[model samples]
Target: MNPERTSAGPILITGASGQLGAALVKGAQAAGLAHRAVQRPAFDFDNPASIAQICAETSPSLIINAAAWTAVDAAETNQDAAWRANRDGPATLAAYAAEQHIPLIHISTDYVFDGSKGAPYIESDQVAPLGVYGASKEAGERAVLSTGAASMVLRTAWVFSAGRANFARTMIEAGRKRPELRVVADQRGTPTAAPDLAAAILRIVALIQRTGWQPHYGGIFHATNQGATTWHGFATEIFAQAARHGETAPTIVPITTQDWPTPVRRPADSRLDGQKLAAVFGITLPDWRDATRRVIADMLTQPASAP
Candidate 1:
């Protein structure tokens, strides 16, 4: 490891197989940073022993946690699994980081906010999650902070990438099969591109290693693409971009949240304010539309059964 790098040991990135996790691994390699990307069985969130085993094996200088129980609807029925992945798992990782005096970068979600505020939420906004998934993630945030380790919690929304089964790919596949699709228009938030987020995270990591951990670095911050849009709006754009890539476009109908019933309640408007990220780290993701277009373009180049 380079002495000028953040840690003398390699950076350990959890959730190495997920969308964002894969992106981070790519970004780290592109930046020529030494990193160890580990996922389940070896670093399974449900198995706390896996967490300790991996940390001990790597002896990482820094850790970036991208692991979580991300199935929103399933979380309602599988609360125990959700808690294990989103809350207890992260709590275990944070505790271990604290014990080793390693700085941690943990990923969070915008669902922590109830969305009743009717405005973009900031770092200090009151969090009132409506379902098990959101509540569990919020609990993990609190757990990480309570450990008093040098940590940064990034809360993002609507993440997608060409590498995983995400919204953009789902819409594309659905459009290819159906002539029309109904999407929720009442729920609104920024659509973040996984690669863009991964890039921003790596930049932060380099800054921390170069400058050392600063007093202002250990806190929560909103990190997403530049703007917000409803699920309907996002789907429409996805099909529009898909059309430009020679894929068939579907008729997307806007529907209210009530039109689509699910096991858990989602926030109507969970747009997060990302100004703090720009102010503190001088980092901001690309505009949502641009990021969406890039992801769609990348997806179009892949085979139909890429995921």
Candidate 2:
């Protein structure tokens, strides 16, 4: 593999408006790294010209692709849009990065696995996505890897943050109106804070730039806050954390996946094992509960209508 030529140009970050993307931009600035954040209209995945245009304009030395069509339920009826955004758009970015001879770090999801392993999934675990959303993301992973570019596909699970629509924000908003909340206890995965994930990504990038790309740096790796919990457990922690911020705690009812039905079937246990990331790059995210508290604090500090 050819080592990417380091340049003084800005690091290009896509999906700058989303939770993770926004956090990535913040992390980059705090690290004093020059970067350019791009989102829809100007950097749309559906519009191939927009993708090419941004690449030419920025002439980025490195690229972080955080853009995705993350509407899981909506993707059921909107397969075409999901594929275009999650699969096609990332493919375009991967190809561009390959041509430019730059390393690309693409954020992915644990949903790429079917969650039937009854144990934490490693990077090489078999993938059997149950919905179009996961399938598209899995396809995107393949696309990025197929480009033969120096790329890192980092898969995280149950992402949440202070910005945008996320589980923490949803639960907090619901607690304000509802007396009790029913969360699925059957499904299990790690609750990844966007800021924590963003920090990890930036660290990985810095390591690559510092030592140049190594053979082990390319390919898939699991990244999320340490530990795992069911959705019900996650909700309980959210309410608990919100209580510390003077918010009222709601009655959290633990229910099975069968209790609530959606168009898509999420994995029953999609917890990702993050050993490879730590072993390869000496990077590990903060504890899941600590990360959860940080995000809950951020949410409580925000205006009521922030989400």
Candidate 3:
């Protein structure tokens, strides 16, 4: 089917309850785009049968797969669940997309890389996932790309939004409760705003609708905000901005990654380059700091006193 108009058919957005999915639904609604956002019992990666059920019900002209098992540390123990969500489910979706001749946009992660590159990662860079979550997502990327469907794997990093349980929210909540907070300083990656990523996805949908799906449009694309920062830096900025709105600014202590150990080793530097996204789709996300400022403002509805 030809992508003549974005509104010509319903756009299917999975993971509707998630941060990015919520943002995509809001963006689509604000843009007046016909779309159906779904999650959980209605459309779950854990329940593979739901995939075809929802697809048939929505009859989506374009599909955006945002549903996935995103708990990083938990994935270590839940390997089967992670693979089912990240790899098998997406593979099934890709196969269906290929069969239906539908265009698909699959959301991916920066974790696919081991983060040893020291510099930013481009779309073509070699993938060496350090954990189960990353490896499963990497497998999903391979599945999507191999399907030969008009699919675009948009890999993003450190996604956060005002409406979800993300780093920013965790920092803000921790900052209010604690007099001092210790944050990981060694790990580096861009903090992509869910709203910004969602808008970018919509722009891609619009572009495809306007120009129709081209042969070159079906591949991986890196889509993160323009800059990078460590978790410590990000937490500091969050408090700095929140302080302006009368929220307490806690003392942030920068600690090494080892100080804050986890079940899996996180990427020391997982920054993704957006040059290809700009060159191809003429799309780019806003700066991390600026996006942080906006999210902080949105999150600080009523400033809470320090504990």
Candidate 4:
């Protein structure tokens, strides 16, 4: 996509109902990127043919794939369905973009890593996914890269958006209903705000176009809010922040990952080192807590106050 032609042609955004997708639409408008967003039945993952058709019809210079099968546990038994959406959907989109030679900005998850490393995972680190969701996302990343679609795969973690059914929303609901809440403390990672991440996505496309970057130039990059925190610690911050906003907050009881005994195994340390995104895209992300504060402020004004 040419940065010069940005003002006229609308940007086609998929998964408009999701957190990241919604943020992209808002960000695009604010940045004067694009207004056209494709959602279910049109851009839905269940129908890959329809998805391809939408890309062809819109012919957007830039295509952002913000949709994915994000149900971590459900993916354990539903690997095929997950692959259909996560892997196959992007593969199809990538192939089309390659035929049209357009640029794509696809959002991915930090779950793609197994989290065995002691430090933050850099883009060059070896990937060893521990579960179905992670495996699917890893596969999708490969497909996007292999398709030669001039795509940038941004892997993020612990996403919490004010308008989505994410951690922050659940915390508010549970904190209000229960006097105390139990949370897992073993997993550690950054909490990325949808809007901040969305801004980074736009910057990636802009940087690539301005530099005459090629398809080989496209690779995996981590674009998450800085710093890391366990789910328990994250919940604590959310509750504390809510209290500051005059909302009732509950005590978060920290527990081990095993204590909570979930069906799916979560990465123990999903923190990603975003040096590559910073160096290549020329963008610096805010701290995770600061991003959370912005989300909480926006949540306070939400009429439905829901995800």
Candidate 5:
């Protein structure tokens, strides 16, 4: 499986406008790593030509594909757009990466699994996406892995950050206006902090940079903060942390999945086992609780932004 690798160049990050993408950009800048981040107009999945143009312009040594159509419910109605962003866009990047012998790191979602599995899922588990969004992402994973490029598909879940619209921010903002909020408790997954995931991605980049591309590094890896909780539990924690900054805590009524139905069917339990990531990359994200605390602090300390 050993293949000749291209010389190192600036890391190219797609979906720069996203929470994870923005965090990656910030992390790269803080670490002083050479990186180029791009979003829509300049680089977009809807515009296939833009992918190649951005790649050519960046001449990236390694690519961290943080781009994807993440709207779970919207995917049901907008299947084509979801496919373009999730599957087609990544396929294009993978093909180009293969042609140039560039290593790629593609971000994926935990939704690939149907959450039928009672326990945490390992990388080798068969994927059974429950909805359009998950199905599109599963297709993207196949495209990236099948290209024969030095690629790693990192499957993460419940990603949030202060930089964008996310669960934590939504909870805080909504709690301020409402006295009580009903959060779905039946669904279970780890809440991954964007900055933590970003830091871990950079660590992988460093490892690849230090040791050169390793064949074993090119595969599926589950990456999430340690521990799992329901959306209800997550909101409770978010409020607990937010309250430290004098924000009011609303009464959170735990509700079932049926109580808060959406267009897409989310996994009942999608906790990803990250032992593979720890063993392979020697990286583990901080616990969700700690990550939540840090993000809440960052959110409060920073200027207010639209959710």
Candidate 6:
């Protein structure tokens, strides 16, 4: 396919079915940026030829890669599957973007850190991945960066969105089924809204275009809400908001990560410092609580059944 012929137009987004991808589609249209959202049964990350073909065919001036293997604990046993999507998939797209000389916007995760440190992780912080999913994500981060293409690697944590199944959705469902829910209280991070994150990506892209990438806004940035809260706190908020939405709220029982043991070792603190994002963008993200409330409101009021 002649890619150069089509490179003169709108942005192209991958993982359209995912929450973040859906948000980007809406955000791009709302922001008045010409764009396309590609997802399965049309776009499949497991197939490299498909990825290459679409990249060349679409020839998007900007490519936002939101596709990823997000099953954290499942990665412990499904390592290859995770890397195929998380590492090789990104590597393929980044290589194409580099060759085409177009900017690639990549989504990353906060699990790259081991979480032993009791402070928020900065863009420059050392990474010590504690699990298979984390390792795969770290590798994918390097893969995209190594391409030397203009790219933005955004690492966010505790994402909950209205369009997809997430912590908030799970809590709301369990709250309806069970009398009480036990959530981990030790782990902490900003409960990023997928739509908010989508907005951040677009803003970065706009900034890159306006600023001419001089500041190399191409590297890693921690984009999330302004504050940190534990899983227990997050669940409590979800339940409370559900009640406010005229729905039944479940009692949330707080528990440590050990008490709610899982196959993977979760970071005690998934907090990502947004200082650089704020400084560079000259803006501060709203608190997670506010974002969460918006998401809950959107979910409860939507016509679709709540997950």
TM-scores of all predicted structures: 0.97, 0.97, 0.96, 0.94, 0.98, 0.95
Query: Per-residue lDDT of 257-284 in model 5, one digit per residue for the tens?
Result: 9998788889999999999999988888
lDDT score, candidate 2:
0.92
Clashes of 1: 0
TM-score of 3: 0.96
Tens-place lDDT digits, model 2, residues 1-307? 5558656589999999999999999999999999999999888988999999999999999999999999999999999999999999999999988897899999899999898999999999899999999999999999999998889999999999987899988998898999999999999999999999999999988987888778789999999999999999999999888889888888999998889999999999999999999999899999999999999988878787543
lDDT of 2 at 54: 96
How high a TM-score does candidate 4 get? Answer: 0.94
Flag clash pairs in model 5: none
| Top model number, lDDT | 5
Better of 5 and 6 by TM-score: 5
Better of 3 and 5 by lDDT: 5
The window of 10 residues in a row where model 6 has the poorest summed lDDT is: 1-10
Candidate 6: stretches off by over 4 Å? 1-7
Candidate 1 per-residue lDDT, tens place, 87-124, comes to 89888988988887888899999999889999899999
Compose the digit string of candidate 6's lDDT tens values, residues 1-307.
Answer: 1222223667889998898999999999999888878986566777777887787778788789998989999998998889998999998888888788778888998999999789999999999988999999999999999987777798988888987889998888888899988889889888999988898888877875554554346689898888989999999888888888887877778888889878889888978998888877765678999998999999998889644
* CA lDDT scores, all candidates in order: 0.91, 0.92, 0.90, 0.82, 0.93, 0.85
Ten residues in a row with the worst lDDT in model 1? 1-10
